[model samples]
Every structure is written in C-alpha cells, then in structure tokens.
Target chain A: MAKVLMKGNEAFGAAAIKAGCKYFFGYPITPQNEIPEYMSRELPKIGGCFLQAESEIAAINMVYGASGAGVRVMTSSSSPGIALKQEGISYIASCELPCVIINVSRGGPGLGGIQPSQSDYFQNTRGGGNGDYRTPVYAPANLQEVIDMTMDAFDVADQYRIPVIISADGMIGQMMEPIEFKERTGRSLPSKEWAATGTNEEREPNSINSLYIVHEDLEKHNWKLDAKHKLIEENEVQYEMYQMKDAEFVVVAYGTTSRIVKSAIMDMKKEGLNVGLIRPKTLWPYPYKAFDEIPKSTKGILTVEMSTGQMIDDVKIGNNGRFPIHFLGSPGGSVPSPEMIAEKIKNILGGEKK
Target chain B: MKTIFEKTKGLTAKPFHYCPGCTHGIIHRITMEAIEELGMLGKAVGVAPVGCAVFAYEYFNCDSYEAAHGRAPAVATGVKRVHPDSLVFTYQGDGDLAAIGTGEIVQAAHRGEKITTIFVNNAIYGMTGGQMAPTTLIGQKATTAPYGRDEAHAGKPILVSEMMATIPGSAYIERVAVNTPANIRKAKKAIKKAFEIQRDGKGFSMIEVLSTCPTNWGLTPEDSLKWLEENLMPYYKLGVYKTPEGGANNG
Candidate 1:
C-alpha cells in the first residue's frame, strides 16, 4: 500500500474498507459526507452494502442491525445528526455489540455552525447516549492519524464488545495529508456462527439483545456494563506529553486544537517561557495518570479549545484541581490561531521567573 | 402430546417476561406457530422493538435482535439485505411502529424490502405507562388522555395498516384482532398469509393486530377482550386491507 494524499474523511473511509468493514450506512452531513460518498462508490465493488439512509436516525439504526449480525459496520455524522442517533447508540451499547461511529464534529447548541469545534468532547467521551455507558473515543490530530485511528477503532470495538468512535472536528475531516493504507491480510474475521445468515447446521439459534425486563435483573445487567467500562479505564488510556521536564506551566488540548497548542508552545519557548503541552489521544480513559505526573515545577495549566471550556473541565479533573486552570476559547466556529493561544498562555504565566 | 410451548416453535427456552394477559404473548405464539408450520424456524430472524415487547429477542428461539423504539423496520431491512436468503421480520407495537418509527416503516416498505412485519396496535403506550400513542383510538381514555381522546385537541388516531397500504412496494397489508375465538382464527390466517408473501419473495408484508391492553385500559383481561370485540373491532374492521390480487397499491 503506497502512500497517497487523501482528505481525512476519505482516508478514514478507505481504512475501514481495508480493515474488513463490509457495510457502511450513513446520511449526508457536512464535514463527513465524503465518507458516505466514498463508500457508496467503493463498497459495491467488493460486494458490500452501502446505504444512503433516509436520515441519521435510520442510518445509525441500520448500523445497529448490521453490527448485531456480528459483522464490521459503521456510520458517520456531524453533531446535530449524532444527537438523533443517541437512542440507537444506547441500545447498541446495552447489547455490547462492536461497531464504529465517526463524529466529524462542528459547532453546536442547535445547528450552531459547520466550522471546526470540539464542543462534542463531553458527548463523545462520555458515550453521548443515555444510561450508564462509556464508548471509548479516539481523538486524531491529523489526516494520517484519522486513517490509523479509524482502523484501530474497529479492532478495539471488536475486542471490548462496545462501540468505538474516531472523533475529529470539522477541520480534521477537511484537511488533506499523506496516508499509507495497511496491507490486507489472511486474517479474515472469524466466521460468525450467530450471524443471521440462514441459520445453517453449524449452530443453534442465537440472540443479540439489550433488554432485561425484570427490574432487579436490569440492575445486574448495568453492573456488568460498569465492570466493562472499568476494565477499559484501566487498560485503554493513550496520550502524548511534550517538554514537561522542569516546566512551570502546562498546556492541555486535543484533536486539531492540540496541533495549534504545540505550535503555540514552540512560540512561547522562543519567548523564554518554560511551558509544556499534553495531548490526549484517547479521550475516554483520558490521560489523567500521565497528566498528573508533570513535574512539581508546574504551577498553572492553560487549556485552549475550539469550544468554550468543555475539555477544560477534563483538564481540571486530571489535575485534581491542584494547579490553577485557565481557559481561552472561541466558540461557534471561531477558532483561535497559534498567536492568539500563545498570547493567552503568556498572560496566564505573566512575569513569573522561568 | 405437545405442550403449548411445543405447539409454537422457533421460540427460545427463556421464560416470557411480559405481564400476564398482555396480548404480546398471544401474538408471539401465533407468529411462532406460523413459522413452525411453514418450516421456516431455521431460516427466520426476528427484530423486536423497545417497549413492553423489548425483550422479545429472548422468546423468539431463532437469531433475533432488540431494536430501539420504532426502528425495527430499518433494522430488519438491514438484516434482510445482508442475508438475502434469510427470512427477516420485525415484531413491533403501535408506539414503536406508528409513532416514533413511522418514517422507517414507511420507507422500508416503500423501497420494496423483502421482509415481513407484525405490527401490534393496542391503542396506547403499553410500556411507558399508558400514554397516548399515535394509534390511540378516538375517544379512548389513557393516562395522558385522562379526559378521553379529544380529536380537536389531540388529532385523530393514525390507521397505520391503511396508511402503509398506499405504498407501491408493499405486497400485503391487513388488520385483524384477537378478541373472540372467530377473530383469533382470522388473525392466525392473516399472519400466516403475510409471512407467505415474504416466503414467495413478494416484497414487504405487514399484519396489524388490533390488540387489547388490559392494564392500561384499567379493565380486566376479560373486559378488555370484550371492549376490543364490541367497540374497537367495529372501527378497525378485521379483514385484508390490501393484497397483490384483490386490493390496491399493486406496483
């Protein structure tokens, strides 16, 4: 697989096809519509299903059905459309099925704007649906990472028996970069005996369900889900922490915003400010343990985001509120440039001896 | 020599969780019996809905799924398209099939999906404590409609079977009730014929069973059955509403 220049959404779609996802169900939503359009052309060539569902509600439900049959399935949408899928997502989680959902997030409160925004940070990391459920989310910083993260999303969902989301903002979805697709393998997915494929002589009837009617029994079901989430938190936290050695200030950001924060850190360093940055790769089991280990010299942490103060809450939680937290953000499609973020960091660390 | 459970096939060993006298149990038996007689027990996969019948996956012995409220038709369409050889069906209630999932049901039939649906219309939201469903009868009293259903204020109940019969892709559409012995026999026949349409690859099929909700109606099981026979039956007439040979919506 030679390296090729592709937009993030197209790269993500191509990676899923390489990873053995045979079905793609999606509705047209800005920032991610390219994914469905790509699948509509590509999947049929391989004898796979590609449906431009009537709406996001229908699209997600179709994915739910396909995943229930123990196949690799996926759907992509933006913020408002993702909200419509919450009900189906809850049921899919309750049943512990494996699938991928991509949210190329845009600004929101109600059809806020289509420009880049991380306002869905809370929604994506916390499962975005009702009930006590947690779907692990991969926060990709660039187009290449978007492709790699989407492929990893399928593997992790299959391993954990839960949905996995590759959460990118509108900018990440639109940005173009060089991506290398992985080689297809002899490792085909294990035959799904429980799949609803004519119920051949291989196995007896099987059921994939999310309902436990007895009230007491339902509680036990939730407890089992709780146990799975705890296991994920214990094993699946990923991050990249930079220049924490003898630093006085820390900067925390993720996804596309994290890239801007890194550039801001370099500019701040040129100005003789001893600042470091922490970028979370997996937003669910957020890198709390690693973020807490930043040197004792760290006095304050400034968080920069495309949304006003959403991921700042997580940064504070990771720090145990030990360090003072400062937030600088531009909401409703106004993204802060590197200079602006650097200026905010300089203000937060005013006149302190480096 | 066989028990009631054996007489009905394609059902799992898990005990039913539905409340006693809940018409879902009766409907489940009739569908399972039809599958057994048709010898499609091995090839059948049912999609259940959220609500009182949410746990339907446990009762249907074949491979099954429990979909979110009102999206069973979309899910069944997915299952059928993926495994075109399998017989797919969605067992849904009025609240799920008519109210929340109206678009999915209409679109799946409109696309000529080769699947079957067993739509149970009991006139109220049985799972969510007797709220007014989209199919709640005119003048019917429910928890939300405590003052009886007011047509001017609440709008008229939707006749789903009649509505879907307008779609060109729908091969069969029928409405029947199970209040008396005669009506139960008619319902069984209607259900069997609906399944037969899918068996013959005739495209989408549906049978809307006008059912009784004893708990929500605040009546005994016996009284609810009588109410269904006397009042509900007259308005929701029991007969084939549409079919390929004898009715409308033929493509």
Candidate 2:
C-alpha cells in the first residue's frame, strides 16, 4: 500500500509477517525488544502465534520446533542474547531446518553496551555455535533494506533449508524511517516436503535429527552440508560498488558502517579526494569479486566499523594482500563520525601506497 | 491366529539402541503403544532429548525432532503451538530434564503448554557413563560422586513430578516405575492418560517413569529392577500428584 514511518525493530516483525510467517518466539533484549513486542501485539490480529520464551536458548529452540513443523518462523535478540542462541542455532543448522534470526547489533565480549555496534561479524559468518557450518547473513544499512531483506530471508531459508540471519546495528534498530511494505514476488521456493509435520500414514514419518553416531555417516552429512555452502558461496554473493570509476582508494564496510562510509566518501569527494565504498550485502558469501573491481590506481582499502574491526578480516581475505589495508574503529558502541572517517582516508593518502 | 502381542504401528522398524536390561526400551515401547491406542500415531510429533534416547526420533513412527540438550520442552511448546491439534510430546531423561533443562520444562508447565513429557529418571547419566545427575540420590555412588552423593555438597535429588504439580498450569503430573509387569502396566496407563490430557487441551501433562540403567548402575538387569523398586520407588514415590479438574487415570 502506502509507505509508513516505522521503527527498525517493528519493521522486522512487519516484514516477517508480510513474508507469511505464522509464528514468532523470542525473549526481550535491548534494541530489539520492539520486534517481539510488535509481534505479540500484531500477530494475533493476523491469526499468527507469538510466544515469549524463558530465555534466548528456549526461544531459538522454539524457532526450531516451528520450522520443523513446516511454518515460517523467526526470533530476534541482541548481542549477548544472540550468544545464548548460538547452541540452538547450531542445532537448527545441523537439522537443516528453515527459520529466520534477527540480531540487532550491540557491543559485546560479555554483557557489553546497549548502543549501536557491529561486533558479531565473525560470530555470524563463521558459524557462531560450533561444527563446520556457515549461516547466510544479510547486513542491511537502512530501514528499507531491513524490510526487504527480512521478507526475502524466509524464502531464502526455505529454498536452502537453512537458518538466515539479519544483522543490523542498534542505530538501525532504534532509528525511524519511512518504509513501504512492498509485496515483491517471482521467488521459486521449494515445498517443505521433508518437514516434520504429521505423516498421516501416507508416507514415512519425517525425522529432523542432527546426531549421526556412525563415523562415516557423520562425515557424509558434513559433506552434504559442505556442498550446500559451496553453492551458496558461488550463487548468493551480493555487494555494491559505490562511486569508484577511477577512485584513489576503496573503503570496505557494511550495515551502519557503510552508511557512514557513504557520507565520508561524499565529504572526501568535495575535497578532490575520490574515495569509494564497497558495501557487502551478504556476509557469509562475501563478495570477494568486489575486491577485484577496485581501481588499479587505488592505494589500498580502508575498513571502518563500530567495533575494533571484526569485518576487516574478511576484507583482508577478499583483498588477498593485493593492497594495503587501514582500519578506523570505535568499540563499545561508539560510532566513528563521517569526519573521522574522512580524516583517516586523508591520512592514508598522505602516506605512500603500501 | 489372534495377535496377542503384536508391535504397535506407532513405532518404526528401527531397533532400540538402549543397553541390555536398560528400561528405556520398555518405556519407549509402552509410550508408543499408548500413542497407538489413543489413535494419535498419525498426528503426533515427538521431541527426543539428547540423552540415551537421542535416537528416539528414528524409532517414533510420527513426525519427530531431536532437540538440543535439555530443550525438548521448549521445542515441544513450539511444535504444539504450530499444530494445535496435533499430539505433541517430549521423551527426556533425568540429565536432560531435571538438570540443564529445568528452566525450559518448568516454564512449559508454568505456561500450561498442552503437551506430554515422558521423563525417564534413572538417577544417573547413562550416555556419559554414569555420572551423577540431579536426580541421583544422596549417598548414591557415581562416576562424579565417587564416595556417594554428599548431601552437604551436592544436595538431595529433585522431585520433578511434585515440583511440576505445584505449578498451577499443569493439568496432570504422576510418578511411576516399570520394575515389574504390574508396574509396567500402571506406567503405561499413566503415559496414556498424559497423552489423553494433552489431546483434550488440558494444559501440561507429565509422567516421571522411574527407570533403570543397568550398565550405569553396575548391576544386572534383574538387580537393577530390584534397585529401582527398593531405592527409587520409595524416594520418588508412585502416585498422581495432580490432575485436571475432575480428571483421573480413568482406564
């Protein structure tokens, strides 16, 4: 219909429901509490189910149960809460269940701060729980992107039989922006024929399990999951290259950091410095190809983040020593200003190409 | 030829992985038989816990999920909410139910979730080779409790059924033992009643079936049965702690 002004957390719930999600289970955490609150209020109006679990562990397991029951389900949490959910997320991943997890970014190592931060890049992309697994992570910078990615996340989850994560910093979670609940179509999702719904005696009972006691059998299962990861890496890499026809250097960032990088690039351009930004949309299937597109005249890539530098490691992998890397970060929920980022770029320009 | 003791269709053809004389197999069989007798085999979704019964999903002839350690009750809540009309249950052990998963199970009961839980309390951790469990009796020797459980240090075993019954939302809570054929019959009756209560949407239902882990207990199958009757039955007791309004073991 028409665009409406909405908070980032509420838009998360609205997007899930718009994706035809019928169940939501979560525990309240700072910066993301509005998501579960929104679902608790709005879901019943649509004949959907919303439950507040005892803890994040229980909430993710509840998501597992609903996913196994062949329904569109989701849960949301902040940093520490997401850490508690890692075990259940791993179990859901191993069982090959489909569900959505929202991580409204906050600072962490323990119970850090409640402000905006992007410190969970490694935990989300490198399999937060355990084992050889990688979850598909989508980093959205703005509220509109949050709505679009949250809705598409479910379909992607079902198509691949994997849990998908939407990582947004506290800024996006708490910010208000005009968003249109667009009803996009043309997605081909596989039917959940393997779901653990009742058998009705028409076929073999479906069992969603992750324990493979046999040595060879466990290896086989790992290989099967590995094949899926490989396919995702090849087909699902999404990134954006902004204003880099013949730029001097590239700045790699995502989510809230990318937004700040855009401002820095604009500010730098006014001063005759052409700094470009490579924004990654999907974190796991990281767009290594984007690094290839960096200009030959570029000195290096500058990575900016809210944390000490979690995503910079990935930038290093994508760059593969092709250029020097610089980092400017403010941990514990502090965001580096656009001016600070521009100054860092100028400092890099002041030095010779490494 | 009349079928005197044919296997129930509620169970799959998979063989049991339980140790010889371990009562988990008996409990599994009777639980499935109860589901079959209730005509819910086609509409049941069971959550298997991560103890000795981790493979229970494979044996259940219905839609099933193997939940993470101690999270079966929460998982069952999810499944029951998704399919309100379907029969939902969790098969759990002492380590899986009483210890790590206490919060989930207690909250499930507190919320009056319409689901059944078959909690097997053997007082020891079998899969991990007989470590002390929260249900391990005081003065009971275990791998972790070499000199027997010290009440001064480890505390007494938790009475899960009694604790669950105290919750206002629980509709049915009972404790039973399967040490003898007569007790086996009674345990089956309690399990079936629990499922019936769940089918009627009568809130939370649970049956703590005092079981035997022969290998873990360092005893023969027969002696393990004796140990359950003499030690477990007396401490855990055998009776219904609560029931729905005007509800009973009607069968």
Candidate 3:
C-alpha cells in the first residue's frame, strides 16, 4: 500500500507472503538466512507456518511435500545449500509441482566465502539437478525488482505448474532500498486440480509422483515436460534493453552486476562512447530475442558477470556468433569497478574497429 | 457371494510388485488397514520412500507422494502442516530412514511433527539388490558385506525404535516383527496405535517393523521368517519403547 524501506532478504519474505504463500520451509544459509528468519517471525502472525528445516535437502523436500499438498511453499538458501537442494528441486520439477525457490547466491566452489557473487549462474539457470527439466529463473537486480518478481514468481509457478527461482547475489540480500508491494492482478492461473489433498474417497486418489518405471511412460512424461518448457520459453522470456538507440557496444548482464554495467554505460555516454546494456530479467527461457535488438552495426558484445563466466555460455548461444562476444568478469566475490568495465568496453570497441 | 475374505479397503486393486515372501505386502496391508480402521483413509496422505517400498504410492489407496530417498519424514511434515487435521504418514525402509535420512527423521521427532512413520528394518537394501543397510546386524552377510558385517568395521546395527523412543517428541515408538501370525497381529496393532497418536495430535510416532527380504537375504520365505525371529528380533527387541500414556498404551 505504502512505500517502505526493507532489506532485500526480508523483502523477499514479505513478497512471498503478499503472494499468498502460507508455508515456508528452509534451512539457514548466509546472505539468505534473513528470509527464513523473517518468515519465521512474520508467518505465524498471518496464521502461516515457517519451518526451519534440518538441512537444505530436507527443506526443499518439505517444499515439495507442501507443494504436492496443493499449497504455495517456498525455500531459500545460499550456493552450497542450494547444491543440496538440487535433488528436491529436480524432484519437484519432475513432479510438476508449483513452489518458489530463492537463491541468495554467495561465492562458491566448495563452502566458499559468503560474499556476494553470481557464481551460481549455471546452478540456477541451467539444469542443476539430473533431468531434462527447467525451472524459470528470475534474476532481480534491485530490492524493488526483488519484491515485484518474488510476488509474480508464485503466480508463474502455479500458472505453469513449475518451480520458479529468484536468484539474487549476496549484495542484494544485504542491501536495503525503498519498495512497494503491489498486489498481483496478472493473468488467471489454473487451480491445483492434480494436488494430493486427500480424496475423502469421493474421487480416486491423487498421487504426487515422479516415478515412471516403464521406459515409454517416462519418455511420454519427459516430452510432456519439454512441451511445457517450450511454452514458457515462447511466452515468458523477459529482458530490459537500456540505451540501445545507437550503441556500438552492448554489455549483457543480469542481477547485481548489471547495476555496475549501467553505471559504466552512463560514464561511457558522457565520454561520447556508444555503450548500452541488455539486462536479462529471466535466465531460463533467456531473452534470446534481445540479441536481435542490438544494432547490426554494433562493434562488439561484452558479457559482464561476477563469476569467471557462466552466463556467457548462454550469451554465446543466444548471439550465435552474430557479433564477436567479449567478456569482463571476476571470480569468487570480487566485483569489477564501473571504471574497469568502461575501460574494458573501450578496449573491446577499439579492437573490433580494427 | 458370501464375503469370507475381501481385500483390505486400505489397498488398491493393483496387485503388488513385491517379490513373493518379501513381507513388504504384509507391512503395507497393516499400515493401510490401520488408516482404514481409524476412518482416516479419507484424510490419509502417504509418502513413499526409495527402497522396495518405493512404489508404495501405487499400493496405498490415498493421496501419496513419492519422496526422494530418506526424505519421507520431511515430506510428511509438509503435508501434515498443510492439513493438520489430516492423517500423514511415511513408509520408509532401513536404508532410507537410518542411513541417508537420519537427520530428517530425528529432527521431525525433535520438532514433534504430528506425523506417523512406518520404518521397515529389513537389514539389507532390497531394491538395488542385497546391499548392507545401516540396520544390517553385525556379522550378517550382504552383497556389500561379502565377509559378513564386521562389528569392528561396519559397527553394530542401529536400534531405531530405541533411539527414537529416547526423543521426547516421539509420542509413540515401537519395534515389532511380522515373522509369526501372532507377531503380524501385534505389528498391525502397533501401526494402528502409531497413527492414533498422530490422530490425537499427540506428536511424532514411528513403528519400526522388522520385515523379511527373502530375495535379498538369499533365504527361502519360510527361512527368512525364522531368520527374522531368531536373529533380527533378538537385537531389535520387540516392545513398546514409548507411548503417549507413558507406557500405558502398550501397543
């Protein structure tokens, strides 16, 4: 109703509740612990339940359970913890259950540092667990975007009967900003007709399952999932094209790192250097069409990331060698300065001219 | 047609895929019958774990979830929380419950999650062939334990019912075997009582049934029953470990 200042992780929790999520199951992990903490404190007030699970694996399975029982459920975790959740996420995806998952990504190869990083690009966007299934991955860059997307995530999950992920870097979780919770008045979503809410013997039992012992049945199930993913890819791909009017160079990024890219773009504009940004709002069902928006005269494409380069692979696939793609990034938690990114753009632009 | 015997209402018309003499069918019957007898079949939600009972979703005639290995308790907790008045239970095997899923089960009990679990301690992993389970008794042979389970190497079999009974949240914990018809009758009673504790919202409840795995144990069905009585029951110890009535409701 009114603008309120809220931290990113806490806002994620508030957004889920606003989306009519009544159940939260999660284990504590850095940069994302506040989500579960906020949920635990606030959910009970609304007659909701916030359960701090024993482990990430158990937490995600609990989400699967609640989702199967035909309710809006959510879980959040950092990178290592998200790794443990892959199993349950895979199961949820396979079972075609609706739930929201939040990944406040931190540095990782092992139990890496808790500093903000986009190191989990593949883990969130790509098929993290075993399967031919995909979850809609949303990389919200700011607190307001976090709030907006987190609310819509629940709806989208139910609309398509799929898990939706909101991947924010550690910086986003720790940062605070002004936001408004706009109640969703989006497209109508289907009711959970296939849920495992007991039949009371009035109807045949509804089983929430992913097991298909027969190879042919499993194939049919997989193809059915593929069709759903295809529909999502067609109808739901989202991205923001910033200052592409006459840009000769485009930097592609998402989440927190894209903010730095924007600053770099602004700085380069003052210097009369043509620079623009294509920020992906959706990772899976990625904004491949955004590449077509880049002026054919563009000298080069620079992909910025907080990792060594995970999203770059997708960028490459999207660009399909249309223009020479360049990279500027740091691994672990170290972020590149705006000046550094502008300088890299200058270098790439200079090289492309020759 | 004079109805001398009809199938338990708890089960589905689909015949079980369990191996002959596996004894999983027995456990499934009693667990479902317990729910049916309690008039909970209408509200019952089941979670089937990964093991021989992985397809329990197919057998149990109720809303069911096929949980990942050892995560059944956690899943059941989710279902129970959503429908607190409904009956939620998990059917898990020794490998699923004691090995990979120990954290979920122990924490569920600690939190006093209002759910029931039917833990089948078959001493070996049957679905993937005869691998040694955490409940495989010391000196018991399995595919993985070619030379028999050495106590020094593999450690003693975990007594799940005893360990569960020690948890205060566990309103009912019992270990029973289905080796004999009288014992089978007792197992059914224990399972029913476990569900009753959940029905009363007393707290967490678990019934650990010592079942036979003939195909995996490489024993005849009859010998498997004898093996369960002579070896497994002695270590597992059939008795009521905990009850809501402080040992008064001796199931």
Candidate 4:
C-alpha cells in the first residue's frame, strides 16, 4: 500500500468510514471542525449519513440513538464540547451501547483556549459522566497511529458493548502525516441481538435502556458491567516498551508527549544514561504491567504529559512505589520542548536517591 | 359476535407505572393505537422521554429507545436517518420537550427531519416530584414554585405547537387535548396524521397533546379534566397551527 499524506482530522474521519461506520453526528468545535467538515463531504459520497447537530449534547444523543438501533455510529468534539456531552455519554454507557467518540481535545477547565492539551486525561479515564462506568480510551501519538486507533476503536467498542474514546489533543488532530491505509481483520464482532430494531411478531420488542430503578436489579446490572470491564482490563492492555532490557530509569508518557519524550530519551542515551520509554496506547486499562518489566537497577521513573501531571498518578500506581517517581508537565496549551524534557530527565538521574 | 373493541396490539402487556389517574396511560394507548391503525407497528421505532413516561419503552410494543432528558428528538433524528423507511417518533413531556430539550426539538423541526413527535404538555414536571415546567401556566402551583408561578418572575407558558408552526420545515403542527372522549378521538386522529406524514417522508410533524398530571395537580382525574378544559385549553388554544397543502404529502 502506498502511503498517502493526510491531516489528522481527515484521516480520523476516513478511518471511521473504513471501520464500517455509516452514521456520524457532530457539532463543530475548534481543532476538530475538520472532522465534521470532512465527514459532511465524504460520508455522502459513500452513502452514509452525516448530520451537523444543533449542539454537542444533541450530537451524542444522536449517537446513542443510532447505536441503540444497532448501527456503527460516531461523534467527535473538543474539550468544552465533550463536557456538554457528558450527560448523553452517561446514558450511552449505561445502556451498554456500542459507539465511538473522538475527543480532539483542546485546553480547558472552561473554554480555556483552543490549543493542544492532554488535560482531558482524567476526564477520559475517570469516566467524565455521572456513573460508575468506564469508556475504553485510546490515546494515539501521531497521525498514523490516529488512523489505526480510530479504525480499531469501532471493533473494540462492539466487542465490549461499551463506548470507546479516541483521546487525541489538538496537535495530533491538526498535524499532517503520511500513512498507508490497511483494512483491519480477524476480530469477530458479536451479533447485535440486543439492538432495538423495530420488532415483528416473530421476535419480542427490543428496548435499549439504562434505567434500572429496582435496587436489586440495578445491583445486578452493575455487577454484569463490572465483569465485562474486568475482562477488558485483563485482555486489552496495550503499551510499547522501548529499550527496557537493561534500563536504570523508565520514562512513561503517551500521546504526542511520548513522541517528544522519545526524542529526549535518544539525547540522554548518547550521554550514556540508561533510560527507556514506556508509552501507553490504552489509557483506561492503564498498562500497569509495563512498569513491572523495569530492571531492579532502575532507580526512578518519570511521567511526561501535556497536562499538569494527570497521568503521573497512574504511573506511580503502576510502579507501586518500587521506584521513585517524578513528573514533567506543560499545562494549558504549552508543549514541553525535547531539550526541556531532557534536562528534567537528567535532573531526576542526578537527584538524591529516594 | 364480532369484536367491536380490543386492546391495541401496538401496546405491550407490560402495565404502565404511572400514578393512578395520570393521563400518560391514555396518551400511550392513543399513540400506539395510531401506530396500529397506520399498520406501522412492525416498522415504528419510538424514542421514550425522561419524565413520567420514561418507561414508555416497556409499554410500546414496537422497538424503543429511552433517551436522556430532552434529547428524544435528536435520538429520533438518528434512528430516522439510519433507517429511513422506519417510522420514528418521540414521545416527550413538557419538561423533556418544552424546557430542557427545547433546542433539540426546535432544531429537529427546523431541519425538517422526517419524523413524528408526540409532545405532551402537562404544564408541570411529574417525574421529579412536580417541579415547575416551561409550560407551567401563570399561577400554577408546583413544588419548585411554592408560591404559585408568578407572572412577573416566570413569564408566560410556552406554546410549542404555535412556535413550531412558524418553522418552514414543520409540515403539520396541531394542539389537541385528551380531557374528554371527543377530544381524545381528536388527539388520536392528530397523532395518526402526524405518523402518516412521516410515512410519506413529508418533513417534520408534531402533535402537541394537552395532558394532565393528576397527582401533581392536586386534583382527581375528573377534576383534572375540568381544569385542563378551563385553565389549559384557553391558554394553549387547541387547533391546527399549520397544515401543508393537500395534506403533509405536498412537502
């Protein structure tokens, strides 16, 4: 396959179409506007439906509806827009509907700025909505990874009967890269026997709902969901270990931050520092096992993120205090340069032993 | 002997969870009856609102989805867009349609979504213990409005059908009440007509049915009917606000 140069947002849209999704409902927000714009132009050509929703709230509900009807559907939005979508996302998760949600996140506590930020790490991994549910979140580092993850997200969503979120920041959403398109294979999706397609006399009416009002019944539903999540955590943890064979220090990072961290690690290696990288591909099922592979000689671990140390907590938890942990972050739309990250890593290596 | 009446097959055997004397039962029956009469029972997909009728999915025999509060219209749009041949309808109450979901409903109609909407206005939020709804009339008492709805503070009740009528995409808009047997017949007729318009792919159609929340209203079912006739009908003004030429098919 020949590599085609494409912008991240356009590649995400194209990947979704290739994943067999036919329904897209989204509202325009900064950095991710190109996604809806691309869908509006391309989806119609493929006989798919693309609707520009009135609001982010409306877009997610539309996804809830289409997913309940047993169709592969998706919606994309940014940080503030994702906040508005929390209510509907909760409904979709509770209903156990299969859908893909893309968060090309921008800086925000509340409309902070329309620049790249990994601030939504907590929001995506902690289940931004009002429930005891989890959305399997994938954070891709580059345009090529974005295409692969966006395409795979639909299958993962269907397999678990849960929502899958592609959490990419504005830099990943706006950047262009060359990528080869490849069809995903070998994942058998379960039959949508529970979908609420209109019923005939031959079959009972199907109701797609999340309302379990009875105390005992609600408890049973929660337990069932917990069991599925346990399976996901066990079977679907993904991470990339770079040069961990004889490392004394491990640098943990993900998304675009991981790319810069990789560059910094290269610079450190040239200076005879024994450092490796553990880049998490899955954020929710947090790849805790990656930390277990660290050699006993490893004295410290550092987590680099675009947010103010959100993923550092996970890194600490993953290592389980076996090693001293440190953090390097640039919050609210600032990207830490490779030199700055290299300096931070050198300081950690030189700092007094914990 | 020939059967003159039987329960509509459009409804399921699942009994409703509504309060005694609540008009939701009647509304549910009539809407399903419309689906049955149109021979759309197998193809009808209903979106249930987040109010007293939140369990509407259990009652409707057709495929159903329970939407988040005020988002039924957007959900219906999704279903209809995916399955264009299917009959999609949203069953929403005042709080779900007139208040919280106002933007979704208005924009759905503005886009001329080919779906039917059954907007039930009972003037109060029944599910959350009778809070003031957007359709709560002046002087209407609600849990949130302990001193009665003040005209100065709450302004006037919203007239959804009249407002929806102004949108170019809305092909048919009607306001009917279900207080009396005669009015019940009219209400069912309007619901059926709205579905028919949707079947013909004639743009958006909505039937705003004036309903009553008896327990919330502090009235018996009988008195609630009288109250609806005396208080709500005058304010809501029951009639067709818009009807496309040669019926909804013209669109």
CAPRI category for model 3: high
Q: Kindly list the interface RMSD, in angstroms, of each predicted candidate in the order they appear.
A: 1.7, 0.7, 0.6, 0.9
Ranked by TM-score, the better of candidates 1 and 4 is: 4
For each candidate, what is chain B's TM-score? 0.94, 0.97, 0.97, 0.96
Ranking by DockQ: 3, 2, 4, 1
lDDT of 4: 0.90
Q: A1-354, model 4: which lDDT tens digit per residue?
A: 899999999999989998889889999999899999999999899899999999999999999989998999999999899988998888888899999999999887887899889999888898679978998999999888888898889989999999999999999988899997775585888999998778755588888888998999999998999999999999888899987868878889999998988888888888888788999999989999988888888878888888888988898889887888888888879898989988887777777444
Clashes of each: 2, 0, 0, 1
Model 3 lDDT tens row, A1-354: 899999999999999998899999998888888999999999999998999898999899999999999999999999999999999999999999999999999998899898889989999988569989899999999999999899889988999999999889888999999999776678799988798889888989999999999999999999999999999999989899999988888999998899999999999999998788999999988998999888976888999999999999999988988988888878869888999999888876666442
Clashing pairs in 4: A248-A298
TM-scores, all models, native as reference: 0.92, 0.98, 0.98, 0.97
Model 1: how far is B117 from its true place, Å? 0.9
**For residues B17-135, could you state the per-residue lDDT of candidate 1 as single tens digits?**
77667788788888988887888888888998887888887788788887887899888877877777788999999889988899999999998888999999888899889999888
Residue lDDT tens for model 2, A94-208: 9999999999978988988899988888778876698988899999989999999998899889888999999997899999999997768857989889887788778888988
- Candidate 2 residues B46-162, lDDT tens each? 999999999999888899999999999999998999889999999999999999999999999999999999999999999989999999998999999999999999988999988
Please give the RMSD to the true structure for each candidate, in Å. 3.1, 1.8, 1.6, 2.0
- lDDT of prediction 2: 0.91
Fnat of the models, one by one? 0.63, 0.85, 0.85, 0.77
- Candidate lDDT scores, in order, read 0.84, 0.91, 0.91, 0.90
Candidate 4 regions off by >4 Å? Answer: A352-354, B246-251
The predicted structure with the larger DockQ, 1 or 4, is 4
Question: Across residues B115-194, which tens digit of lDDT does each residue of candidate 3 receive?
Answer: 99999999999999999999998888999999999999989899898888888888999988888899999999989998
